[model samples]
Target: LWWCPTGLLTLLPLHAAGYPDPADTPAGRTVLDRVVSSYTPTLRALARARKADAPATADRRLLAVSLPEPPPGGVALSPLPGARAEAAFFERAMPGSHTLRVGDAATHATVTADLRTHAYAHFACHGSQDVNDPSTGALYLWDKPLTVLDVAELDLAHAELAYLSACHTAVGGATLPDEAIHLAAALQLAGYRHVIATLWTVGDRTAVDVATSVYTSLVDGAGLDLADTAHVLHRTVRALRDADPRDPTRWAPYIHSGA
Candidate 1:
């Protein structure tokens, strides 16, 4: 586990830090190369997510959203070319997974309503971070931003996992170092048992590929287990880091933020 000792640390990806020397042996040199990691805003929040394990069954549902449109009055966001691939991965890897593709149908209300019905969720879209008001940080939808406060208001007992493939989903306010007022923590507060989120803005292509690899590993022939997810991400990120030893940004932003 990585510790965020200050507000600045909350904005950085501590888990992604690499070896002090390039020539150093790859074995156990980085967090990703060693243990399965889970991020928690606090020890209490971590305990809540681990209280119950996700049930393994064919009926397990995943709600995937891909928002390719720019929001009203918001800065224009280039459509995520990787969103389709990310959505397709969930559909193929998880049984009974459903997708809300980028289109007229994938509205905010629609996605919010679907959240209540699904056990897992994947959001492939733009994220807005309000540095002054961390609770206002949001994940963009077709109609509006799904703010952190909106997520906290939810009572989703059935929700088990959430993959936030967006920018700075785990970033919190500089003013509130201990509160953890960010999208990743908000989702956990809302009831997700495990959450895969990014610590900063991520590359479009790498995000899709890494997200796919993580899910594929978790849902291997045996089936998906929530406890195994952290290791799955660790292995996948390590592989990405191995492919390019110099670029920690490519593999380091992603983190498992719950049980």
Candidate 2:
């Protein structure tokens, strides 16, 4: 299912909606159990993503950015100790095909430059959504924040998947309710064929587990197959849901966007 939600509907986790209790529905009631869901800002956006050429096999490099600690002289945000684990998983999974940038190395400039060169990008950090102005929403880095506007301005021709392990990446501004102007949408606008984002704040430990499972299923001896991304995420989330059937919070926030 390719969802193109407008206004407040964009803020909800439609893919996870349905009866949470297994006893209520024998075959499982969630949208996730029924189909592999992905979001797009519009039908035209989906069409454009589908029309774009796939990234070359040789160019399937991964850029993994990890910001476990907050930047110096800034608003004191809680540290994400699990980001390091997530970064390490990417290194182990991709090995020679990955660039691991952590701590002071994950600067806005470096990440932006790396995005242009890498076919796949993964950000494990703090994400802030400016509810007043969604375009100002950003993924916190070393030097500064990589704003939605910053991402939307870029033209990443080789871009494939961008797994945003940070929080509220898919949440749009309440002020501009109809506008699809969040970090996830911005990445799609920047030319990423697919994006994995969260609808709200997610636990650091949970993020690590989800990333590990999702990537494990997606990665092969050669490299990641972008075609399997949505289904892989669906399966991963279903497993998570099965582990704790009552707590949708543990599994539902993670969403896939674009092609």
Candidate 3:
């Protein structure tokens, strides 16, 4: 098999029907054919050249665990209070029914909690990708120190949506399990309906602001047909981009989504 990074990026966009779902057209097939053709050669060459073993993603099937029933003390969903008094203009735009978990920085609890229950989950934290050691790429919670250990244990099956709302958790490693962006792949493998992650860093304030707007729109029922968190995140981030294109902080976090 051959490997071509260009295909997943360019072909998917040129042929996609929309976010979370790409078009499976002749063009799409061509892209896929190339990816299939490229894989074997890419792997063999990389292994031979680098002399480094790649991570295992042999279980190509997405984790299809049935959604776990809400257990006792399932989730503690709450909005960031007091801070609301000082909410940026973006905060006021938030509508009702947006079940968010807010803290000084509660990324870990929020993620762990969201995995256990809920149709939608949002997070604003610091995340990084590891091109060299794909498994080490991880998210940095506002409150907790994020590591691969945490993500490895997450039950992603119940999570219909996961919005990383931070920098580059979307990128996939080169190998099957090695997509440098393990977060998205892992979420897909764990059976999440959708996982939305970023490819680069964003300003903390900007991230919170974008998340505020998008989740607000979602809670108001704008994403009725949206199948993936990436769609919601894309909409939100794009709005921010339009609001201020010059803000490198806004555009840097490219989407690495699995829908």
Candidate 4:
């Protein structure tokens, strides 16, 4: 399912809408158990992503950016101690195909520069959504925040997946509810074929678990394939839901956007 929600509907998790009664059969329980869901800012954006050329297998590179500790002299942001572990997991999982930019190394400048060369990016840090002005929403880095406007301005040809294991990366602006202006949408506009993001605040430990499960299913002898992202995410989320059916907030917040 490709959702193109407008106005306040953009803020809702349409993909996760369904009854979760234990008595119901698996297929009838929730949307998570049914079809794979993806969101698009518009139909045109979906078309553009579909038209994008797939990067060569040999050219596939992963950029893992983690900020476990906040840099000094900045607006205080909570430390994501699990981010370092997440990046390290990626390094071990992808081996030579991954680059680690942890702590002081994960600056806005370096991340943007690395995004150009990498086919995939995994940001394990703090994300802030400016509800009043979504374009100002950003992923907090070492030197500064990588805002929605910054990502929207990029034109990456080889971009594939951007796994934003940060909080509220998909929340749209309250002032312009119909605009679909958020970090996830901005990344799609920037030429990433797919993006994995969160609609609300997520626990650091849960982020690690979700990333680990998703990547474990994605990586194989043939390597990661962007085409299977939605399906893999669907399965991972289903497993999470099954583990804790009472807390929809834990599993339902994670969403896939783009092709």
| Predicted structure 3: clash tally | 20
Instruction: List the candidate numbers ranked by TM-score, top first.
Output: 2, 4, 1, 3
| Candidate 3 per-residue C-alpha lDDT over 1-259 given as tens digits, one digit per residue, 9 for 90 to 100 | 2223432342122211222224353323322122212111133333442332222222111111111111123233223222232233223433342344334324457546645554444444446676566676665544554555566677544344555654556555555545433565555444444455565555555655665555455443322233333445555555554465455445535443333
Q: Note the Cα lDDT for every prediction shown.
A: 0.78, 0.88, 0.43, 0.88
**Pairing residues by index, what is the TM-score of model 2?**
0.95
- Best TM-score among the predictions, by candidate number: 2
- Candidate 4, position 203, lDDT: 92
Q: What is the TM-score of each candidate against the true structure?
A: 0.90, 0.95, 0.52, 0.95
Task: Evaluate model 3: give its TM-score.
Answer: 0.52
lDDT per residue (tens digit) for residues 163-241 in model 2: 9999999998785453698999989988988999999999999999999999998887656887878888999998998
Clash pairs, model 4 backbone: none
Pairs with steric clashes in candidate 2:
none
Runs of candidate 1 with Cα error greater than 4 angstroms are 2-6, 24-27, 53-59, 71-73, 99-101, 177-179, 220-223
